[model samples]
Target: MTTTTISEVKSINTPSVIQINADIPLDQALEELIRNSKEISITRGKRKGKFETGADKEGLELLPESSKERLQADGIDIQAGYPEAPPREDIPIYLDQAFEIRNYDVPFVDRGKNADPEKKSLFGAATEIINLTKNVGTEIVGLQLEDLTDQQKDELALLIAERVVVFFRDQKLSPSAQHKLGDYYGNVEVHAQVAHVPGLPGTTVIWNDYQVKKGMNLNFATSNLSNWDSTKYLNVGNQGWHTDLVHERQPAGYTHLHLDAIPDVGGDTIWSSGYGAYDKLSDEFKKFLDGKEAVYVSAHQYLDREDPFGGPKRIERVHPLVRTHPATGWKFLYVNRGMTKRIVGLSPVESDLVLNYLFDVYEKNADIQVRFKWTNSKQGYGTSAIWDNRISQHRNVWDHEGDQPRHGTRVTSLAEKPYFDPESKSQREALGKYLHQWD
Candidate 1:
């Protein structure tokens, strides 16, 4: 029998303690105790000190009675208590100390389901398809994402496969609608970590004031870290370019972000093309990396089973460095400067040199990227961007500087595992649009 003390909850005056012997993990034991035990001796105490002004407080304040009623009508569990706004004051920032297991084993679905681009008109209601840049981004001018038909959704999936990212403006898209759109693409990823919208399982909350609300002693916004790599270059700990959730077995496929609130100035987002990045490399270098694999680390840290007392370590997953897009059969550079670590068989120094150069090729190229500023919409509604995460990397520009608020909700769908097909061709090659200058 292992004797342990509950350090997470400590008594202010006199300790109220409970100890039991069980053949299970401490965290599992605690969870079982909370669920089964009738008489818990733990006393709830009012948290001392100031609270950070964040989304939770703002969202709770802005939550309408109709929304709550709708949630209840839809059979949402209301027992999960909401956080109350605390007095605005500074507090020390601490890391997540709770021991929780995060595992995802659901089989991935093919994102390009029943794609029929040849069908009469793909956009259905959309009047125009605006290519934002030469390579990566496109904007569907006339349709609301919420109103897309099954065929249109399939066409949109194919379009995103080709364009990498597409945008829609002046849209009245709700969290539920956005989630449905995500479901059409693949299995919507339910994240264990991060703050989610109330009653919405997979919808992640993207608030500018997250760090402050979470008691982090930081002056800048949480989005600031997205672009930190741009200033630091190849330095360690700088997250420059990144595809979301690359650590998952079946990595993130389609990621939809709808920003309901935008700042007057700053807070733009930029995305770069993986297809173009792959094309930028020489045939010799491409051949060298075609079948190679690299390890990707998770954004959140987890405990190492070998040393439970030791600090948590980031979860890692290995994927092909050059992956073939399932829909387009186009080879794209699958590695990102953020999550991707060293190559599988290469020495640490060799991997570093190769990865740094590959990252530079993707990040330094301007022609293969698109930078979009979220501004006025047609109906003064929110703007949305749906991107194929398998072939693109994006970074949020933190130029807003905390003067204004930017909040959004994001839903991501997990698709098939990263794979490389030897028979796959690069985008330009497949389109018979070879670069004469390079030749």
Candidate 2:
């Protein structure tokens, strides 16, 4: 049996992360665990445990004593809180990539609300990030999704959480890599109501043409136009800004939409920052919206077509109009024009007025948004737009009216339900740059 030692650990670049190989001999496992735990204790200054008061909760947390109850041993090896993988339930989202996804570390300070924050600069990661807008969008280059180390992935999550949307050019990311990238940040979410790539389980196919499926059909049938079409297919949805899968309570966290097939002209997409919308609201308006909730319903789901992608019935959910970002503790206006049905606790007319005003805030504001004209280089490189749906809204521009069509796959990650915390700061306050730019 091969044994890993401290010298071997030091030889690798992982100063803080612990790499645990699966199915190792019990003796070797214990030795490495104990040795690594000791090494962690000595190196506590740079990286602190989850329970400890530290700069950032980016450090690994100790395995809980309670987890010991769930440990299983099979004569030669020990597995902690492990479940048997069913044969039929197996499909590799990321092919050729290998690594067990480690459990998420406890954040440094629960968004720095209760603990002292470690000093962090604008671009916290070592990746190349070019800001596309003052508040909303950023283009991240010099890195591929497949090549990200665990720590770098964590940092990228933090960056996108703050920036709202990060764009990539020429990233020929496969559906597997796209899904895996979403998994690194959170759970790869399968669309309950939309069609997906044939073999790729969670990767959604946003085919903007004839082959598109049942869900989101009304939007396609309407051709993203303002007026009613000849067929009169309900005539409203998705031409405006929207967050994907917001019809559910626990909305999608991160969305990696890869536009592999881009039209040469008129297929540009726009992203607006929810943080900017919230911050620009009047103090009285903000206070009025603080505890209020809104009900969101998907128009396409209720369309009079047979359900194409079969799943559970999509249910309308009530969520806070103003939501707090769990990672950064920043506040954003969460209401979107696409799916938002009504504001609860208000009269129908009052709800209409309020919702219309909120929609106006997102639509009229160009200061907090970035528009990207999608394209590929002369060589075969492509662009993908990744966004934090919780604090952002995106609209796909379909001005391209030729035989060439727009097509892409989108992967959405699951996150906690939309919520509002009175203590949460605005996006402007959290970043410490672009102050009052939106207002």
Candidate 3:
């Protein structure tokens, strides 16, 4: 029993039978921990005097209010979820560390493409979230959107924030439920700049279903010649990476997207960890970036046509390049390829040089990202990936043809405006203790 963060020492969805997913073999799990130990470690006092500005500090000294909320949130005991496990056991792990996989008999289902759990899977992503990637994602086994409970909603949000992003496979989540899920976090944020669902209010319909005209003759010769892929700095109509609605004065906290209609292989989406990106910066660069401001403009495809009723004339706001998470108190990079135009104080040249460099830092690193393939499951099946818009960036790859449907409803929830706190820790440090290897 070494010094551990509260999160590590406390119950992870206690009494819920939390087992390491069965699909993850022992060696693979250990390797993941080893990776966590190396790439994600942010131990206190590790960077003393490394930068001229000072050194990195570790916060999250206190467990959040959600920790208390977690206890009352559900009645699930640790044994219920995973009823099948081997007897209590332990083995000496890497060096001074040892991890024990106690195979206690519990209800742990590693549901993939065809998941039909008698009770849990049919419920929703909240009931059966399985860790899908090493660093960033968790897949909810077989949860139905309509079956989610109030406690599950709260638990799901907390868990998504934990994993950065969580996925639900074959979800039949209705637009109303999607909207309701958004409401669980905060008010349904209506987009001031992008197109919203015509009658449903607060929903955005982003798809490429309309057929191009078959009879092309007049402008077809030159029109078809202009390749969309060749266009630079063009907003390819939301295909590139972006945080949703960053142009708002107070950016949306959570964005939930359900891909009900996706092409078989071409419409996969990927998300990168802002917290990981922040952690990877050199101390000097980190010092230079922290507390710096960036300006994001909601122009291009985001121009607000709904400004007829005295809406915001322009969508623009200045936010810290690195911001602290309100709940976990972790610092995450806030700039994105889509909305962030320039670093506020720097000159145009300096901003472009530095921004391009930082963008490369994120774009080049695959370790901090998770790419997902959608099944576009039928009426009772599909996946809705929900994430903390504040601490992550995502983009959809448009590999499909124009006629293939990739339809989904999105709901954004409003939260506090962006602000950076010096005392914040990175997500690695915040959850490091829970990472068995680090603790």
Candidate 4:
């Protein structure tokens, strides 16, 4: 047992001594001194009971040994705390390198300007006369599928690669003919879970009248209503902004809708370019959004809320805030009202603010949108439209109310999953592929 007194405790960048009253074992006395001390110094005394000087510190001694090792680890410089010295001034973020804001304004031009003249002409008269909007989309006319030759097919494929969506008017092709035409583009797959015309396996019918009647149990008197219930009814089924059938592990790629029967009034479809929506966002918003993900679940729209028919009915999937079209290599706004739920990295308030702002942007940009109004003309009867699901959104307007029933068949194409690419930006070639010259 030994007795010691702290005498005059000094900090001196080292452990200070504390005095003990009684003669005691070194360990016990040290523990009692530590317990009684007003504050404990960060540095502990050396085994020999002497405070460690800067020259004898273990950390200082190990620095040379660490430097002598051939393999050097890369990370924060722990020895220096910060590299070289602490930042003198708050580091300035280089906007160009730290963030990139893409231009969404797509230019309209002759898609064949870069191709050989002979090869360009090979798409037939339609390809020759039709021009594409230089901007993010295109509207095509003149070349009917019935008259499309092999050269035209090739040209159309090229156009599709450039423009994300293509619209044709006065098609005059039957469901079988339309399916045949779609076959040239890709493998046409039937929508696994939608109303289809009996016996017509390839076609999915967008039936407002039929759906309404069915809802009312086929009783006409009970189903008649003066006003339209946009939410409750299927005036335009799948009206929300969404890529088609993204709920499935595998989603449909190409969507073709032919206006077989047009009402005398109302019943038009509107499309918005996802690429344009992405391009219009502010740099601050884009940076905050970059690398963040969101949940997309189909069951939210398809499943019953009160008593979910298929178990709890949740089909959540994570998708990036911005995604690049795999085929076109263009960035697009990846979220949709129909499927997107909460953003992955954001708090509830933050997610709502950002998503609502994006939704407003998509709604306000008229230049990046196209509205297809269906007329009862013979040419309108033949109108068939095909668009890329990965980068486009479509909505059908249900304003027609008459005894005359309207119906059409849709053929969907199977496509690969959506992904994002940070390197490539939206280009004219990509825009030209879908928006034909004839807008």
lDDT of candidates 1 onward, in order: 0.69, 0.59, 0.56, 0.51
TM-score of each: 0.79, 0.65, 0.62, 0.60
Ranked candidates (TM-score, high to low): 1, 2, 3, 4
- Two-way TM-score contest, 2 vs 4, winner: 2
lDDT of 2 by residue, 30-68 (tens): 434533353322111111111111111111122222221
Off by over 4 Å in 1: 1-59, 62-114, 216-239, 378-380, 436-439
lDDT of 1 by residue, 132-249 (tens): 8877898988787878878788888888898989899877777788888898788887765455666676887665444344333333433344344532332111124678888877
Q: Give me the displacement of residue 298 in model 4, in angstroms.
A: 1.5
RMSD of 4: 26.9
Candidate 3 residues 75-161, lDDT tens each? 312222111111111212231121111112222211111222122422444445467788888887656656776556656666666
Best by TM-score: 1
The top-ranked prediction according to lDDT is 1
Q: Locate the minimum summed-lDDT window of 10 residues in model 2.
A: 42-51
Worst 10 residues of 1 by lDDT: 40-49
